[model samples]
Target: MKQKTIGLLGGCSNVATAEYYRFLNEAVNTRLGGWEIAETLIAGMNFGNIEAFVRTGDWDGLGRYMKTKIDGLVAGGADVILCVSNTLHKPLEDLMDRGGVPMIHIADPTGVAMSAAGLSKVAIFGTKPVMEMSYLKDQFQHRFEVQAIAPTEEEQCDIDQIIFDELVKNKLKDTSKARYLEIADRMRREEDAEGLILGCTEIFLLIDQDDRPDFPMFNTARLHCEAAVDFALS
Candidate 1:
């Protein structure tokens, strides 16, 4: 199969951005064997700038900023695009509306996985905006018929704090991890959430499927990368 160049619009947090690159290359090599690598283009943005755009609720400005990044990737021969941040998909979709190379929506793969797993309800963990926003929840509902749940407002603040104050900065603490798991447990017990979506790209840094073997967990970053690799090799 001929591989298409995968364009990554990243650095919403350089940590997750780097993981996307590594996951893409490793997946390609595993499939093809013997030093094979994905044809790729990375347009890394300054997180501070992206954060500012998000915080100010400047959707138009964010869309325009991301469009410029996507333009560079297309100019560099990228056949497809993937923005590495879940929260940024709103702007990414705005860019899509204006037309460009084919792009993957990060939530789609996770939604598909949820449907395949027969999960009717799932909890989401992400930045404050991501949890409060409908971008992912609505997508899951409309596309997969899955019910998406976000933690309570207090839980949302705690998760958001950990993401920005620790995970994005590459600081992982056992206390934070424990608190996250406690929240996950509460979601499961109270909301009857059958699974959990690691909605933030950096969330996997704190906890994963291994933390609770029986609970269904969707790591959006890894799922997104796998989907991109599948498309690249298709």
Candidate 2:
């Protein structure tokens, strides 16, 4: 099979982009079993500008921005696009529907992994945009047959702050991780959640691993990169 160039639309939070790159290279190299590597094209965006549009709720502006960047990626010979951030998947999906480019939704593999694990209900943790937005949550329930529960409004605010103030900046504090685990544990019990979805790309930079050993944790960025590797090698 011929390898395809994976276009990464990243920098919604740079730390998340770094993780995606690392995951892809490691997986691809391990699969090849030699010095081989995946063909990749990275178009990193300005997080400040992207966040401004997100904060203002200007999806049209965001869409146009994404389109422009993606156009450049496609022009540069990217066969498939992967927007590394979960929140960016909203416009990215819209673009895909319009036949803009072949892009992967970050939630797709998470839903698949959950379904295979017999997980019906899961708690979601992410930035306010990712958690509060029903696009991904609705997709999980309707398309993948997985029910998702987000943290409380108060908890959502905390998650958002940690995402922007800490994770994006590459600051991972033990206290923050403990607080995140506390919220996840509460949701896991209160919502009867079968698992937890790390809905934000930067979230894994905070709380990762099967901390509950018995429970599953879906890391969106890692799963998405794995799926991208699949596409690249197919």
| Tens-digit lDDT track of model 1 for 1-234 | 478999999998899999999999999999999979998899999999888898789988988888888889988989889999999998788687565688999999999999999998999999877899998899999999998999999999999899888998899999999999999999999989999999999999789999999999999999999999999999
Name the best candidate (by TM-score): 1
Residue 107 lDDT in candidate 1: 93
Poorest 10 consecutive residues by lDDT, candidate 1: 91-100
Give the worst 10-residue stretch by lDDT in candidate 2.
Answer: 92-101
CA-lDDT, candidates in order? 0.92, 0.88
Candidate 2 global lDDT: 0.88
What are the RMSD figures for all models against the true structure? 1.0, 1.3
